[model samples]
Target: MTSSLFYHVSGDGQPLVWLHGWGVNGSIFLPTVTQLSQYRSYCVDLPGFGDSQPQPGTIDDWAELLIAQLPANAIWLGWSLGGLVATRIAQRWPQKIRGLITIASSPCFMAQTTPPWPGIAATVLQQFTQQLEQDLQRTVERFMALQAMGSNSARDDIRHIKELVLSKPLPNATALAQGLEMLQQTDLRQELPHIALPWLRFWGKLDGLVPRRVSTLLPQTPQSQDIILPGASHAPFISHPEDFLHHLRDWLQTTNKGV
Candidate 1:
């Protein structure tokens, strides 16, 4: 990992790393940091977003880069695309992960027929990829709008997401393209069953990008748990931070007792 991949560490308790979703930076987790202040938290600007410089590679490569920087044996909380990266790290470096939490994330972000996993249509993703090439700013804006589509407080959610994105430097265009490609091509369904760490998956009932139907297909291990927020959308942490944090704290206290 390069020194340019910026991260901020705060609080003073069990270590927790917060990974933001696509098109945004570590600042996306500002609400999370405030609510989950009991734990030592590392909020990272994934390579290419915010102050971090871009590094081109596959999902696995991105995971490796992050793994190099992250503290050992820390709880990882990833949102959207960051979830996929977190899963990759857990799969490859199991000993480094204490627990795994995925918010509004899916194993397979693009739809599949044989397994019937709910996801975005490939063509729609392609359209976003194409649009991104022409107008990076507008494409990101459209994506932010889509994230807030199904929330009960859609207007507020949209405004909140927009404000966060604008708060940081605009994400690198190359990084945006790479993230869309990862969403389209990366599939971890087969690997899900092998992850041995305690796993908690959070879903938004009204999420448009990652359909709630995918939750039904998650691995059923003793260590695995799934929660779907009613009337919440893709960005539940932004839209329903209280409910999100409530469940998160409960899970941390119960599932990861010693952490």
Candidate 2:
């Protein structure tokens, strides 16, 4: 109900909903959305990011909010935090999701009792949260830079992300704080089995945030597909736009007749 959850719907054909990573909004996928203009695309702002304001509920509730807005049985694509949200949507409402595409996202972003194959150490998240609490603005700047670690264009990517992040500005301190908490506490390993929709997982080899090895942690399903992008960072759509779009188009064509 909050206008803070802003979205830009473009293109024509079946909806391609994009969810962005933490600390950023749907704009992170702007390159993809622009290139894939032939397909109906909806880039959404997670609660607290972009124009979306903080809401009272868990991350599952945030998924529900997106589901509520989506056209019936729309195609869903999420990156990092967005991927986690998409997974939750599939679990909660399998019938409404036509397919799932996760970009540089995994079932578990942080290690748990079961231990995700390759995920950020719990200590890293804890330190980030601590620093963020201590200095939200500075922490966000550092996080933007961290997204492109180990990349040739790391500096440019960081600058671009910083510009994008600052353009909209964070909604409120409460939402930002709560969203960070959600990111740290969320673990969807147990819920992955409940997803019955066709699913696709993507990873960026150079992504320091969600390491490529995280791809191995995904639960094997009958209708699941996985792709790994070489020489790509956390934001592959930006780093490898052509390859990313090509693969995306091919997957859409093969899967649902580009429905």
Candidate 3:
């Protein structure tokens, strides 16, 4: 087993595993986690991304491996690519998850015949992928910049994201390529109906990565709720901590009778 898959645990209550986005480790959720003192928080660094070692299989294999590393049942909070991981968890093993909260994520990142909000063009993704192949370090920097784009706190947020990425030494090239490939091919629209747990979907209204309208793709259930963070970009957990915590706490209360 790779050490990169290791998790950092803190706080106390029902378990809450934090799954970070691509190009980053678990520290990306620090702001939100600070506010979630009531839950036992376990922040997982994706295989090959932080202390974890690279997995030798498909994305599903990696996801399964990661899932196995967690507690039997817990609330999953995933961001960006981590959200995709969370989606697969709730879809394939709903009984193992108490609830799900996805922030700045979309069911499908790649554009579809029916697009979810406007996402980066295929050509743009390809270009970035190519850049990643040439220089993984610069690629991460570029990705972090894109994540912070249009935010008033762009400078600090990007810096924090950079620090998060650097906290764990840069992931190897193969892992970076695989991550981007997963982003390109993953489509979660049809699988949305399989999720049975309460889902809270959070979005930054100004997110350039995941379109705000993509929230509609998920299966509608009485337990599912969608919220938009105004003037926030893709990283609402950092850019709008207060609002993020407000909605998250409210959702926790409404669903589990208070956290």
Better of 1 and 3 by lDDT: 1
Query: Each candidate's TM vs. the true structure?
Result: 0.97, 0.92, 0.94
Q: Name the candidate that leads on lDDT.
A: 1
Q: What stretches of model 1 exceed 4 Å from their correct place?
A: 1-3
Q: Candidates 1 and 2: which is better by lDDT?
A: 1
| Tens-digit per-residue lDDT, 1-259, candidate 1 | 4546888888878889888888888988877797777889999998899888898889987887888888988999999999988988888999988999999998789888885677989999999989998999998888888888979999988888888778889999989989988999999888888999999999999999999888887878888889999989999888889899899899998866754
Go through the candidates in order and give each one's C-alpha lDDT: 0.88, 0.78, 0.82
Off by over 4 Å in 2: 1-4, 113-116
As for candidate 3, its clashing pairs are: 3-51, 3-52, 4-51, 4-52, 4-53, 5-52
Candidate with the greatest TM-score versus the true structure: 1
10 residues in a row with least lDDT, candidate 3: 112-121
Q: Which parts of model 3 are misplaced by more than 4 Å?
A: 1-4, 114-117
